[model samples]
Target: MLRIKKLDIFVLKSFLLLFCGTFFICLFIFMMQFLWRYVDELVGKGLDMNVLAQFFFYSGLTLIPISLPLAILLAALMTFGNFGERYELLSMKAAGIPLLRIMASVVIFSIFLGGMSFFFQNVIGPKAQKQLWTLLVSMKQKSPEVDIPEGVFYSDIEGYNIYVKKKDKDTGMLKDVLIYNFSDGFENAHIVWAEEGKLELTADKQHLYLHLYNGEQFENLKSQSVISQNVPYRRETFKEKHTLIKFDSEFNMVDGSFLDRRSDIKNMREISVAIDSLIAYGDSVGRAMHAETMQLTYKPAQLSSSDSIKLQKEHITVVNVDSVYNSMTSAEKLKTVTATKNRLSSLASDWNMKSYITQNTDSDIRSHQSDWHKKITLSLACVIFFFIGAPLGAIIRKGGLGMPVVISIIIFLIYYIVDSGATRIAKSGGMNIILGTWMSTIVLAPLGAFFTYKSNKDSAVFNADMYIMFFRKLFGIRISRHMFKKEVIIHNPTYKEDWEVLEDICNSCEQYARTHRLLGLPNYIQIFTNNKHDDVIKDINQKMENTIEDLSNTKDHIILNYMNNYPFLSTTAHKSLFDNRWLNLLVGIVIPAGLLVYLHIWRYRIRLDKDLKTIIKTSRDIQEQIKNQHLY
Candidate 1:
């Protein structure tokens, strides 16, 4: 028996709640998208409520695989984001709990979801897809409800148009009706006009009967061959007339067997079997086509007994095509040329038609194979997205739908675009079906791993300040003043002693600025190759910090303010640009900046000169303030 820990339960409860909400939302969104795609087929069909319900039900089921991965991604992001936002994750880490341990419950749940998604894809998805498409086809084929409005010609019926000047709703009667029937052919169309008429459906609801009180029918008897001749037609006037029109009013379900052979309607096993059969059939057809082409292009000459005997007698004669043509009479030449032309044309047409059929078959095989791989790829996406989302959420330290929603959408869009492109390429046989189908997964799996690793170490992956400093260093941008916290001193004045130390520091800075080549190309290379200036910068920083600490003991606020103006030099200012050796190497290799490197070095040299000047001036200012004030 396994016992669930409190932490696991807490994490699981949070994640499961978000997952359920997001899953249904995603499912509804995708279903709406699917519905919009087939809106034309669904609308105005007067479909039964039960039929619509079944369609939406099946559509929702079919879209489960598509929505599952996105839901897991969003839920995991929100869950971990909430933890990070509220400092719960920090507390956990402080209490000796690792990120991986905290994520154990959610990861298990995501794995279970992935398995469920796979089961749905393999079992429910295919059946739902089949039923949904079948219903759509049936709806498209179903006749529109007879809704003829007055004063407009209604052509909803197969081969007829009806117009009514006025209609009586209560009695279902039409006055001044006109009808055009072209079922025989447009050229032999018949037109009828009635003073009054009534329409009714047949007992079986498969036909319509229209009874006219007084009407005249005109029939056209025009022939295609007699286009220039006078047309003949007949007209008949009747007091009472009845016409029967074939119209199926009942909602009949299409046979599922009609779409049973489609790839979308098959399970993984069926798809695999069908793919194998198709590939085998394609191979056999290719061999047959190759044989036929070879037979046509490389025909062997017949050898009779007489020709064989003649070949053994004296000299062998080689026949040339030009000579053979020249030997024929004019009439024979014409006949031969015409026959050859006809034969070539027939062969070309047959080859084109057969090639087209073979291509269609091959495309079908690729589509089936792609779908088979798609089921697995979509299931795997859930796990991949979970890793990506959870780690990213923890790294960004953002909760709710604000930042996480934006990031999730961006990531999901990238995945969607890549997946769509790969699927298109695979469908067109531009790449291997398996490789193309799994391309998005292949691309994103490493990203998820990288994020997880970075988040586990509590790395500031999205720290704007760090990246800004890096860019500033790269571009050789330096500001005169640095942002620092201000402090007030309340002890008795030690300005005299501190002022002396400040002057000595100023003197050293001035001497160092003149003698040291601290910011040129040579210094840059030396810093990375060997830390030649490390001790000097470290010593200076230590002295600055020590002096600031001693100054904090002074009582004069004026002296303390002046002393605070002297900025402490950073040790990293003269060190290598990046702390990571690998990153430095990568930058050096990728950006072989000859001129840019020199420019950056020149800029840093100027900045260092300015910083030294500023430090010297600040120290002198403090000394001047201490001299003007009377010592207590």
Candidate 2:
């Protein structure tokens, strides 16, 4: 049997779980449209198997791109969440492994997936969509659910006024129902009522049944007086109620060609771009959240009401470009030179207004492009999410399904909202193509980075401690290790001084031991410390926990170093680290990759020199760190 480390197993399992979860979720949603939109056509028109299968297959492909990013976003968050919930993230961090390293691997994997998504969107999605529409158009009838609501009266299905009451929990039996069958025999048709009936399942589960216990029948003849008859009905059960729905209930088959025409390349291109723009908008919004959070931290003071009001007023006003033509009177407009000048001025003014709008409400630009933006936006979202996810998972320092699902859902909803909003705006023709496509990514990428940063710094975003506490309460079992030193000291005070001293020593010892990859004080010494040792060690453990907390604060870097080297400062400080070239290469790669991305996005000419210099400095810093480590 092959043996694998727990970490590897966890990563693999998490990916698989996320992948499957996303796939099924997307697939289910895709399938649902058939019931809601097309089932009636198939059943009523008696469409062939090829047409029906083709409809589903192509429809599924058309949805793949839209579904890919959500799937990845959800899956990654879930995978990491599961890891975090299990405290696997904690274990890795405690071992002095950087969360960034773990994220690097996951991100690399995500990029690959992103590429796959893009391929699907470009190659498979468009053609499939055409086929799907063609198949749907060819069908003469729609599915039953399209026209029938369970427990409601409907007159749309064929020539019957049907009502469904109670239904069998498992078998889908309609307990009480009525049907007025009037196919061309409008005035003479009989009305039948049933106490119970069941919907028959075909390849497509969209059929209805009626079983009446007791009811009266009624009929009206066009040429004669109306007739009514009393009838006693029992479980004269209407079994196998297989009824096909017509697809052409609302739409004519002759007109279906126009719909198919509407799904041509031009339409698809528009749809694709719209999706892309929406995805971009989602990322941009995420980035804005990240930026706002950082700004809030850096500048915590509240804005004055006057300033807030001024900003609000500006937000509501639209750019005025029509004024350019106002200067030309009717007589002046007649001159060729004046007319040309006016046209040029108007064009320039329009451009200026667009530029102003872009700068002032960049996020809004994503909303204004067109339907084409969404497809492109959604496709690109897959890539943007990879960057956010890898770092986020690493930061959370916990690996588990539950946390990942929650976090992923939160991130996804945010992305979805912004993306959807952008799409709406685009559809309304209020923004441009580029802005709409990239807005969400631009917004959310930084947010993902900010969260990643927090996670890396050991922020409590994942709330691992809360989970531990909850688990303890749930199982009615307490782990002494989780108890704080102050609590333990208050409970057992006999050797408080010794315990406190030991705690300081242990904190230092743990830090040095981790850095040097060495054992702490000998086992014999630990054993000798005994019951008295437990109290001392417990206190020491508490102090170490405090140190861990302190490490998360950027301001506490000096304190962290001092505390870490306390007990074994002389020995651990002198230990040597491995001079691995692979590590150096990784460092080299991260600097350029991160800087290039940042620079490309912030493409202001004034900042080009400064940005380039910063990139160079970052590269140098990595080299310096590697050199310093070697010297030590």
Please tell me which predicted candidate would have the highest TM-score against the true structure.
Answer: 1
Stretches of candidate 2 exceeding 4 Å from the true structure: 1-14, 37-51, 94-96, 140-372, 390-401, 462-632
lDDT of 1 by residue, 510-539 (tens): 777778765545544443444235565566
lDDT against the true structure, each candidate: 0.83, 0.54
Tens digits of per-residue lDDT for model 2 on 21-106? 77778667767865578554566544557655666677777777767776777666666666666777778779987776655555
lDDT of 1 at 600: 55
TM-score attained by model 1? 0.86
